[model samples]
Target: MRVSRGVPSVRFVTALATVWGRAWGGSVSFDDEFGLFVCSGMRGGFARGGTTVGGVFLTRRPPTRALLRHESVHADQWARYGIGFAVRYLWEELRNPGSRNRFEIEAGLADGGYRAERGITRPDEP
Candidate 1:
């Protein structure tokens, strides 16, 4: 959808996500570089390594730089699509599981900790 900044719906969704992260009892802090509210130390209630909702990234522990970089792209996606992004993302996931998902590919599969197929390998791998 590529919504512009200052959109009320986007802001509302972002704020809601932030509150959701807080309700999980995670420590929240803003990362100015990626424009994300990093919420770590969550006990449970998320998927995979973590999940980004609007401007918030929720995880069990501090994320690596590469993982943050990958998740930053998801923050941008939420900004672009607003609340609708969730439905779109779920559809994509249903259609293309794991690293095959276009959104994950856009965010960098290796950075998100998904093994790449078709002979592609992460730079850190031997």
Candidate 2:
């Protein structure tokens, strides 16, 4: 699967996220470092950094470099799976929710900033 930005499927997802960001009063900005769309101040809804909708990363607070990196991993998953990413992700969520999911594990709990409260440690970690 070629995950090019020129693809129509990817473009459509980006457009959908743009509309959602606008509706939620979230400001969209492109992060050159991570090469993803960041939508900040997107509060009072299903809060998350995502790629299921598009290459859009939604957050209530300003996104950090690490956060963008975490979301970029999700975007890669979206590109790899295309429309099926959401379905597969949903299935995974049903099986394992939160930091326990394999996807979140691959994304890295610390890098994803979801480890702060959970106090998770990798098998290799001391």
Candidate 3:
């Protein structure tokens, strides 16, 4: 869920998928077939497979609309670039943990405006 809009600069570092899911009343889980890895920490993230796949270390998550949108992007990346791309993303991040890249910015922007222009700030900044 979203925190106090009345307060700004209260930054917290978390996975983009988790934040988006929480905003829509859900949580994130890691599954070999289906898990979410933020772009900041890695190039590609995985989500667990379901139905079509059988017992082969499958990872899965609950069904949620927010998750679909957020995670689908990762799925696309994996498909386009294959697993090697993901590996490289992870490698680079492991070398430097301070990298907050494009995905972070995009996620923040998507979640940023809500109560502000809508006049939801409690007697706050303009």
Candidate 4:
């Protein structure tokens, strides 16, 4: 899975997890720091989970299922790469900026999943 610059959702979450590792468990909650993130990516956000290997931040607001997938993939991303994986993740994305290979890219794809209300894009790519 790769870091997403756009929003995330649940559909993408599942895919990203597949690339990194099987998800043992996951959930959503509110946070003053980033609003939303996977347990693994919670590292260093205003959120309480603290900096994990993934440690991602949504900064603006919480997203929908698409956002969930976006963040969840990050969870698996850390699981696959370790705390230092962020740099590598960036490197990979930079090296290959294509959705065909990246989780976030897949997340935003037409087959990707998204919420109905966000208006960020069409709901449920699949």
Candidate 5:
């Protein structure tokens, strides 16, 4: 597990997310191991599995290890790209929705709970 210290601006965004998570009635806690603030039980205001803003992860429930692993990659992306990651991600998502998104591919489709459909053939059909 690589620990990511996002850039200053990204960290500031994370701090804001953390505060929002708490205000949204989520249980916020910093995980030293992952170096992320895990915010669970948010009433609303996230999409899909959850949302990771820099080092803060906001979710509706406790996350599975695979989901956390997927989200950690997003955190790394935020660190690498600073605050611009959000815009880049949106562009990528618009260009390639769902499993086709480059960031999602980089993060591992299976880990992110997306079906892997590249090379498997059904035994009966093929």
Candidate 6:
């Protein structure tokens, strides 16, 4: 997944994640426990979870099944789009901030633990 000398390099991100994760008291593992790279000790920035530059998932705490599922959706997105994923995501967010963004909507508000702030609801909810 490493692209040599490119705008978006997976290897670059992976390498950075190793150091970054360790700095935050986390580590990177090969197992796709959360369907992608999971960093255990990330803080600030992404309160819930975020896909890093190299498609790594950094969470403030251990992710629950629901949170993992939500982040997995984003992982799939990154996989499908590769480096362009962030651009597309940013574009969508810029066009429509908050839960209204289709990506976030697709990820599920509750699944990503954004139900309250984003005002998201499941189809089953009233």
lDDT, candidates in the order shown? 0.78, 0.68, 0.31, 0.40, 0.81, 0.63
Better of 2 and 5 by TM-score: 5
Q: Write down the TM-score of every candidate.
A: 0.85, 0.80, 0.31, 0.40, 0.87, 0.68
The lDDT, on a scale of 0 to 1, for candidate 6 is: 0.63
Candidate 3 yields a Cα-based lDDT of: 0.31
Which has the better lDDT: candidate 4, or candidate 5? Answer: 5
The collision pairs in model 1 are none
Choose the strongest candidate by TM-score.
5
RMSD after CA superposition, every candidate = 4.3, 3.7, 16.5, 12.3, 5.3, 5.2
Tens digits of per-residue lDDT, candidate 6, 1-126, equal: 222223455445556766777677675654355546677766543433555445556756777778767776666666556677779989998897767677777767777766545455544456
Note the clash tally of each candidate. 0, 0, 9, 15, 0, 0
Off by over 4 Å in 1: 1-6, 119-126
Instruction: Give the least accurate 10-residue stretch of model 5, judged by summed lDDT.
Output: 117-126
State how far residue 108 of model 2 sits from its true place (Å).
1.7
Better of 1 and 5 by lDDT: 5
Candidate 6 ranges beyond 4 A from true positions: 1-15, 30-34, 45-49, 52-54, 116-126
Error of 1 at 22 (Å): 1.8
**Candidate 3, number of clashes:** 9
**Per-residue accuracy of model 1 over 3-112 as CA lDDT, tens digit each:** 22525776776677667777888888877666677889888767899998777788989998889888888888888776888899999999988887878878889789
Candidates 2 and 6, the one with greater lDDT: 2
Return the number of clashes found in candidate 4: 15
Model 3 misplaced stretches (Cα beyond 4 Å): 1-61, 95-126
How well is each residue in 3-104 modelled by candidate 4, as lDDT tens digits?
A: 333324433543454333213233333333332443332222333222223433332233445555455555555555554555765687677543433544
Compare candidates 1 and 3 on TM-score and give the better one.
Answer: 1
Tens digits of per-residue lDDT for model 3, 61-118: 4434443343444343343434343464466546632123232122231332212233
Between prediction 2 and prediction 3, which has the larger TM-score? 2
